[model samples]
Target: CPALGDVFCIAQCYRAEKSRTRRHLAEYTHVDAECPFISYDDLLDRIEDLIVDVVDRVLKHREAHLLDEVNPTFKQPKKPFKRMNYSDGVEWLKAHGIKNEETGKFYEFGEDIPELPGRKLSDKSSKLVILMLPPIISPTPGINTSTLMIREVIFDRCEKKERILPIR
Candidate 1:
């Protein structure tokens, strides 16, 4: 295995196709990071820390004036973001009466949560949302991998919650 560390990049990007999630943009600055050899929890912790640090710093030195003028009520998210598995998220959505636009039915496992439903879920839940797939035990020998093939749903207070939908 190769040495592992986190790498980050910021760039102006655009996709040919449209995306429903607010996190996506036709033209936006993308903040990306990659880290190998870390557990999902560790990665989450790192991401949380980075977001808090960046937001705080930006508000303090960079965009405070603009933010104050435009949206003074905006507040930085608190640390230690919450975690929930996919099944529970689906239950929460169902209990809350969130439904798919096409089917007009409450979301179920294996159904893709489109942008509207995802936004509805976020509007109802806590501020930050993060969905994490637990480590996978490989069926084949000599490798352990957790591809995003599993159908699970998890909702939380952060932007990562969009992934709660299955990859249909």
Candidate 2:
């Protein structure tokens, strides 16, 4: 079960962080701060890679059943596995009114949706999309432990909303 609210919150946080980073870069450029020697392209590339890694770790953790048990609420029952094609998932999101701002498409799941070609992970098939949180501080500490804990938190949040709303 995936809680939509939590997922949405994580997505928002990721976007905000990205925005802040870009703003900081612009400020540094103006002030000529010795903000390292990384090029803008390099920074962007690193961010992309970091996002992918986080998503992968979260997905694996969820798949391993490491999440906490969620309290049953007004959640809808999980749907059976459908083995849908990648395009199908995108279409489904579009049908459900989820739009991607980048491609002007509706399949984007922010940090949760991986860059998979097809076969979108969905709660319908007991497949969850995990989005890892960025490191708390520079030189993030306890990478493994923190990631696992975050995964558990995300899992519990999602489980609570497994079937709360109908998917289009």
Candidate 3:
């Protein structure tokens, strides 16, 4: 078998969005890794592990006091972050009586969760949410391989969270 390896990058990025929100920035730093060979389950596991590890490191580091001051309400997210499939998330929104912003109707499966609604859902869900199976499944661009991609988002409750929503 040919040797295959993971690829990662941290780069300055810009968005072409017209609507501005706390989460939507004209420019930001994007860090991502492409592991074309990993299984779906493995990707989820790795993401959780990475989040936990990063938090642990941050909390233990000498500059931990800075984080405490910046987000005084912050706390270490529990292990095995709550997992919600797209369908379940839609059901949760519907159960919570959250309506779609654009359509002004009850949220249905395959609908994009608007920011406010999504935040409400996340706030009620837990500290760290592992939302999986977003509406897109396309071959990843800028990465070496052409493997179909899936989205696995981890939300932090204390701050505005970024949604790595689109995969082109």
Candidate 4:
């Protein structure tokens, strides 16, 4: 471990941009963690372990019954979330016939996918793990392992709700 070790902070973060959706908030609590001297695989494992531990704790808590009321099908998502690179994800989208409503062409690399809820499989609960980001859009050039994107959408009472812990 480096001198700093792994540091975590729950700080209040604000987004200046205006957004009407519930997913995009103006002010929200941010949990930030920085792990130094660790391999990319180690970081991913740490995240998966944390998620599993948290879910186990939550299910064991006194108010866990409330979760059942909200969603009886809620279960611990399987381990080692599915990993999908950017280009591959785009291909999946194209194959599924999901594309930009305005543009009839498939999304090219380096172009941010505006929204993709159909990425979820009907029977499986899997989150996307983008391993290699495109260089054209990556803020950190030449650094391939600095980012981990796990994006998913959940429908609550027929409402589209996104579930992604902002971790980078």
Candidate 5:
């Protein structure tokens, strides 16, 4: 098959997830893309571009009024989203005294940052910052799943909406 520059799918997807998290939905429109011969960095860049482009188009159309109603002060994110490595993020969490809920110990390297815990960490960072963490590969029993990190959008204090856009 000849290579295609970039292909994306935005479809109605369903998942039977047991946990209740803001990031989880029983059925939602899932947006995914595939690009042949692209490096990981290229993939990240493409994803950021797609998101920003979509938001820009929406804001330019009448749908933006609907968006504004939901988030009145919502604004299009600037380019070059902030990024962080997995090890560095773990250190940041430890430095801020965030402990794992399952194990009372501090979050260490190779530890999975679940949605709730990730939100807690995002709460401590600057408002509207994007945090990207590397994927975790585990060989232990009952922990073999590769969990993609969280993308938190936090509404900061004083009822002002601040967002954290994490992409990995």
Candidate 6:
């Protein structure tokens, strides 16, 4: 996997590509050069410098937004005030139209609720109900089985709302 710096470099490259102009040309070129030649030690140094520069710029910008010298006042309330437990979150989900097979327990839209009252499928059930559901064992040979399983799970989870079920 590429390191954080590499990812940042790639993003910077993309932005540079989008905003290609004479003034920004040098900055984009630097980012491109920074991408491929990143040896382990070079990457570490570049990442450290990047972190320091980012911190310095953030501190400077935030200082300008401070109401008092000692502390800065927040501009707006942060979203998602606090995290809720799984059960509480599930209850909220149920309130919002996701039906739990059981009366009180609420499962998210597409989340399989095997523990619910009317649910007959086991929690570990792997039966494919959706036709578009990719096979666990890939038709293409040589591709990793584990990779295929992961892909299948992701595809199913992503398409859960669209999946046709007997109850639905």
The models' CA-based lDDT, in order, is: 0.58, 0.34, 0.64, 0.53, 0.58, 0.35
Give per-residue CA lDDT, model 2, range 25-108, as digits (tens). 322211111224455335334434544565457546745343324322222222232333333455566676665556766554
Q: What residue pairs are clashing in model 1?
A: 86-153, 127-157, 128-156, 128-157, 128-158, 129-156, 129-157, 129-158
Q: Candidate 3: deviation at residue 34, Å?
A: 2.0
Q: Kindly report which residue stretches of model 1 are placed more than 4 angstroms away from their true locations once superposed.
A: 20-22, 69-72, 114-127, 134-168
TM-scores for every candidate against the unseen true structure: 0.66, 0.22, 0.70, 0.65, 0.65, 0.22
Which tens-of-lDDT digit does each residue in 1-168 have in candidate 1? Answer: 235466778898788887766656778887776665666577678777877797789778954799777667665777666566555667778888888778888877656555665556555555655554422234533233333333322231221323532111
lDDT by residue (10-111, candidate 4, tens digit) is 899899887865467888987667776666557666667777788899989999999889778675754676555455556766777666655877766545
Query: Relative to the unseen true structure, what is the Cα RMSD of model 1?
Result: 7.0
Model 2 residue runs over 4 Å out of place are 1-80, 101-104, 108-121, 124-168
Cα deviation of 37, candidate 4, in Å? 1.0
Shift of residue 145 alpha carbon in model 3, Å: 13
lDDT of 6: 0.35
Best by TM-score: 3
Q: What tens-digit string does per-residue lDDT give for candidate 3 at 56-132?
A: 99899999999867778776776676767766778888888889878889987656676687768767855567666
What is the Å distance of residue 99 in model 5 from its true position? 2.8
Candidate 5 clash figure, as a count: 0
Best candidate, lDDT: 3
Task: Give the range where candidate 2 is weakest over 10 consecutive residues by summed lDDT.
Answer: 159-168
Candidate 6 weakest lDDT stretch, 10 residues: 159-168
Cα error, candidate 3, residue 86 (Å): 0.8
- In candidate 4, list every pair of residues with a backbone clash: none
Instruction: Give one digit per residue, the lDDT tens place, for model 6 in 1-168.
Output: 235333433333324254433233434433322244454345434434554565457566846555345445322212212222333334454555556645555565434333232122211123212112222234443343433422224432221112111111
Candidate scoring better on TM-score of 4 and 6: 4
Query: What residue pairs are clashing in model 5?
Result: none
